[model samples]
Target chain A: MVKHKIVLLFPATVVEQPFLYHLVKDYNLIINVLKANINPRKEGTLVLELAGDKENYDSGIHFLESRGVKTVPLEQQIVWNEERCTQCGACTVICPTSALEMIRPEMTVTFNGEKCIACGHCLKACPARAVEEHY
Target chain B: MKVNRTYDEINERIKKGEAVVMTAEEIIPFVEEKGLEQAAREVDVVTTGTFGPMCSSGAFLNLGHPMPRMRMSEIYLNGVNAYGGIAAVDAYLGATEIPKTDPANTNFPGEFNYGGGHVIEDLIAGKEVYLEAYSYGTDCYPRKKLGTYIKLEDMNEAFMFNSRNAYQNYNVAVNLSEKTLYTYMGILKPNLGNANYSTSGQLSPLFNDPLLRTTGIGTRIFLGGTEGYVSWYGTQHNPSVNRSETGAPRTPSGTLSVIGDMKQMDAAWIRGVSFLGYGVSLMVGIGIPIPILNEEILRSAAVKDEELFAPVVDYSQGYPYGRGGPLGEVSYAQLKSGTIVIHDKEVPTAPLSSYPKAKEIAEILKSWIKEGQFLLTEPVEQLPSADSGKKLSPMKIRSRGEEN
Candidate 1:
């Protein structure tokens, strides 16, 4: 099984469709939405994490593209500039995952890339603007 | 075992290259492993630090009298206004004072690119700043108006005098309402989506000197890369807050009002910052060295993040004081874990204070003590304890014809 984060853009016509339901039932995939902004009869954007077998994941993407829905894989990761970072724990508090933490005694920030979900919480919370999103 | 040492004795040892020094970060583990008795005897001075936004801070500059001296009534420094209420040629540049064009609360605060704090930073960097002053023109001081440039060195006595700073501990801020909130704690996502905690935790000045035992009036400190003194107890200093057995406040408690010479400070240590949608503030770098007078002092300095806890407040409500009640008391360890369980819901966490910068200040102070350039001054008076029953009540209006 593979886990993939992707953004789905739905046009006004497909806003009423059960595209997500079809992906789960047909491809046997597990879907967890990170963010969604959708309005009826308007353009909608969705950020979701999908977990399924490689073949099924491929089929789901193909299926989404065929329905006039734009499916874009999420490849953005947070980049922390050490030179600019004051090691304030601002990013650690908002991070959904335990990716940013203050090491004891020394009292410095340590970033674990593997645990980061790229939620972009740190990007907004960082006062120094040291954390950036890079594809 | 009890430890005994004096400031003079410590200095004497330092003069003979026999004194032991360590940063608060370095001494904690050593004290834990070696025992307080041994560690207290081995360590002469332990430097503690905190780097956080201190809004109640500003610099007073005595600009040398221009060609013709004038009692300036209005003054602007680098586009940001300064209070010229003092004597002629003297001005106080508040940290939060912004430019007139960028009136605070008139529009988005993020649009304000610079303020008085930036002017101070520029001055410390050896950069010249535009100065504009106006007066009614007195006989002795004839100049009505003047526009020129000035540097920090040109000012006769430029000193940073913060009214309130070094908060003992602070609250962990979060938003519980549907709408997002912009605050000094940074932007809080709607519905407790994320929690931002500020403070250096154990590395903070007051935490290390809990109860203000060794951090009261006349205590020498490292303020913005220079030597400074604790002038008095900070404003709104409510020592009557809840505290742990080790004397560490569970909430915000004792604070320090400090004064330091700006001429001895460096630009790298002091910074001006704005919280985007929030207002402006000054990022002050302060380090206070705690002397190991006894085992109690050693034990207090050994307090860690796990032992410290702060209330996670809901900022969606009107002022932090009226944020209802806290979700619960959360340790710094749990706060730094990125996910705190509040009301059975997981909330993300962040911090506004810079631990990295705090650590750097601690290290810098350590080096200064090791080099025998910095000597810790024993506080002349200990701060009043919480049991003092000092109440700060709001002023009430007097009724018409009320008896005295």
Candidate 2:
């Protein structure tokens, strides 16, 4: 089984649809919602951790897109600019998760996208401003 | 029986590819195993390095005279203002200088995306930088203003004359307040959630030559990327500080003014960095090679991170308001260990200085000397020591009646 962190955006028209229920019941996917927000326009946005087999995960993603829901990998929203990074490790201690860590001996910072909860601590912690979020 | 080495002696061995050279970090272990005397006799030179955000860094640029000579009274590089009071076409672009349009701290924490330091990095990287200058038409210089793009190579002269570079030691910043604090030392989490320090510890040049015995004015060094020289004692050079047995300062003390040609520098060594809410600064890579003149010099050069200490100051209160002294003191070894206990609380530690980059710089300088491409120089004058009578004083605010 593969575990993935993703975000789903539902347009106003389909905001009330039970897409997550269908994925768990029909596609055999496990849904762990990290955050759920509904805007004044009635659009629903969810940050979730989804776990399922390969075929089931693909089918689950397809189901979301089949409706008016847009799926995006959670890691894709956060960008760590390697070229601009000085590898000073100021963000290493600030990251709540082990997403940002110092690779010892070499002392360079390595980023693990899967582990990042995108709490945005590193964004302010980095002296080099190497970490950024699109949304 | 005395063991000693000279600049000429070490340089000869380096020229012959026979010099026994090691980095500051390497000398520490070698001294422990072989003893200071033996290491002194064997090691010809101990190279030291540091890479940190130096806000006192800047470049003096002489963007060649415009089409019809203009005595520039004001100038901007990449939208960031530079000091243009030097001469007709010369200006000093400081690292912390931001554009006039920058909202700064009005929004609490400014992004500080681009500034003077970025322009310097862009120029060094062979990138085109927008240049704008304004002046009143003069007799010898007719042009009023000029707008153009200039590269480092195209400039008449470009050099870095930093007023202060490598600090001998520095404070380990932490916040004791309930709110998070943003500072030049990086962000300090509330209630000392985390601590931030910015020295390379054992590998640092100033720490290696704690007393400033061999590393001083006129001494050759690696600045940015190419060879540079220590020009003078940096501003705020406080030598009247507590010292270790090896003569290393216990707190923030000595600093060096450095100069170098910007044309020969590597873009990788000279970078532009931002400190969240603080501002922009240049991350400079500097290395100083200390010739093993005697066992005493060797003994100081071999000082380790465990022996060097930095004061843990509360940035929110003690620092800005000068309310009181540091909360406590911690060794560089402890600072580098990822965590330190303060007031029985295990506070995670982070370093703004990169140890790997410092090691890389030391290795590069070692290679340059080993290949005979570089040679050691005896400093014409030494820096002030623990008894130099140099005192860093606070400025007195003046009133209208005060003398100009």
Candidate 3:
């Protein structure tokens, strides 16, 4: 059976390096990293893409929990207030895994649970601060 | 007052292929030359270069000192005000007019006819200007040769072809920086079209061309020696040659290439230099944390990564891995309290080495988030504490709730 793939996201800083190093070293997993562009004016975040078996994935989560890190699961209703939404579409556009989609005709939006890697771009992009993770 | 490493020492390390950590004082000279202090003071925000101006067509590129070497100190500053020194300023130049062209006038062979006088005025005025000095549709001469207007439509097709080729190349770089990655991606404007244009004058559909869109994942981090990472991206059009009878009309033969073939000659000439400076800035910024949350820790990690990674990657080569110019070195004391100053100067020409380290750093940062180790630093007032017993009153309430 093929193992599942898990992704971890964090800010780019030294504080998180030790934790990431340990996770990468112990798990023997392939790590994917993301960060903001060169300009300081542009806002960006870092993402870690991990590929491994269920045990390794669970172990990574447990390690984060042990260190008091909050782990929000990917793709849930994520309560959203349409009033506060600027429709910047950062959530839909930056969703590396493509869990979110924009409904053009009705001007509504939808999210697919299975597709969400849970990078939390919607949380950052919503200028109105309307969207929040429900879990 | 100079702090940590002297200028000579830093230069030596840079010459020796090592990334020199810069301090605030060390970077002051460059900032002063760039006239950044006045620009920063006058504008609330600023943007510069092709990407800076094009992305915010109506905004100004705030000038900043080179990225400081002190890792922790710079981060503290950024944390205090995310928009302080690096925000985009309002544009002094007004709206640009896209010149209309007349296909009927075969005398001027091109799709657009930008007034020569207007073009010169914009360039001299320091506007975020874009021009195709050489293109099939337009003509651009040095300011001195403005009076000499020769009709190229009949005389030399080669001259017209070369000129158009040059302009297309220029626009490719400009569009890459202004349109593709920065303006379109950063501002979330999808109306802007891709850079690709066929000989038949047809443009590729939006998001269809990878060259016109940002790579799906973060590939690098821009280190700072002055302010932060400064980069440009775009496709290049290489004109092809075919044997035709002497009288046959010239066929414009070129395809728009993405950040493909990192080793292509023009790629090195254009993207390499733009990205090298960007890489240097990334190192500087990472080495000294800019005031975002957990900056100190991030700086430390970035420094460690730089130390480990710089040696392994070859700066002499193009893209992916390369060492940048000398890292400007400075001391901790200067960085903590002193301001990293910049004066006005012409933008420095492209750096020697071509490495995609900036992209690499960005990639690493993107992955770090996945690890769940990243935490945003909350404002001090927002943190719970005994001394600050008062809670933030409900926003958007105005007064005691009185329904309309």
lDDT of 2 by residue, B1-404 (tens): 37867788988999899988899988888999998788888999889999989999999999998778999988999889999998899999999999988998899888787787888899999999888999988999999988998899999999999998899999999999999888998888899899999999999999998888888789999999999999999999999988888888888999999999999999899998887788999999999998998998888888888899999999998999999899899999898888899889999888899898899899999999888888999989888888778999888799989964
* lDDT (tens digit, per residue) of candidate 3 on B210-267: 1211111121112211112112211222223221221111221222111111111111
For candidate 3 chain B, the 10 contiguous residues with the lowest summed lDDT are B158-167
For A47-105, candidate 1 gives per-residue lDDT tens digits of 78889999999999899999999877654445777766777666665566768776754
TM value for model 1: 0.80
**Candidate 3 displacement at residue B288 in angstroms:** 58
Deviation of model 2 at B146, angstroms: 1.7
Off by over 4 Å in 1: A1-82, A89-126, A129-135, B108-110, B318-323, B394-404
Docking class of 2: medium
Worst 10 residues of 2 chain B by lDDT: B1-10
lDDT of 2 at A89: 89
- Clashing residue pairs in candidate 1 are A88-B354, A89-B351, A90-B351, A93-B349, A93-B350, A94-B349, A94-B350
DockQ of each candidate, alpha-carbon based: 0.30, 0.63, 0.01
Per residue, candidate 1 scores C-alpha lDDT tens digits across B81-151 of 89999899899999988888785666653534578777887888889999999999999889999999998
i-RMS for every candidate (Å) is 3.0, 1.5, 19.3
True lDDT of residue B385, candidate 2: 84
Query: After best superposition, candidate 1 residue B121: deviation in angstroms?
Result: 1.5
> Residue A80 in candidate 3 has what lDDT?
59
TM-score of chain A of each: 0.70, 0.80, 0.49
Tell me the deviation in Å of residue B322 in model 2.
0.9
lDDT of 2 at B117: 82
